[model samples]
Target: MDILSTVELNDCPLCLGPGLLEEEGGHCVYATCLDCGCHTVPVNYRTEAEKLDAAQRVAHLWNVGKVISEGVGE
Candidate 1:
């Protein structure tokens, strides 16, 4: 698995679906659920060095069920 895959996230709190890690333009990261459209707020970062930290924070938010129920993909 890749480094991001190793970040770890729980099943979707809303629908028990698989969680996805999304990085936007290398500026922010967030976690999203594929099934029920649940997602965590994006964590912004200033530099490439901060990407990992932001991703990890989003993953933690996702694991703890801190998410918004709107689908970004849909």
Candidate 2:
């Protein structure tokens, strides 16, 4: 499955505005908005359908607005 063919570059949930930078590394792919420091998890999906499902889950979680932060020491 091709990431570019499955994902929409413009409709990034993390971006929430516009101009998202899509990045792919190792076993996952995600989008990021540098201005907001917002990004999606590098979902480990083997198929295009799985990737879409994972993206939906991530978007839902982001929409819920329950952010969890951890300290370096912790």
Model 1 misplaced regions, further than 4 Å = 71-74
Q: Would you estimate the TM-scores of all the predictions?
A: 0.83, 0.46
Model 2 has how many clashing residue pairs? 0
RMSD of 2: 5.3
**Worst-scoring 10-residue span by lDDT in model 1:** 65-74
TM-score of 1: 0.83
Error of 2 at 62 (Å): 1.4
| Model 1 per-residue lDDT tens digits across residues 1-74 | 45467688889987899999988786788999889877899999987557778888999999888999865533
Quantify all predictions' global Cα lDDT against the true fold.
Answer: 0.84, 0.48
How well is each residue in 45-66 modelled by candidate 2, as lDDT tens digits? 6776676666655444444542
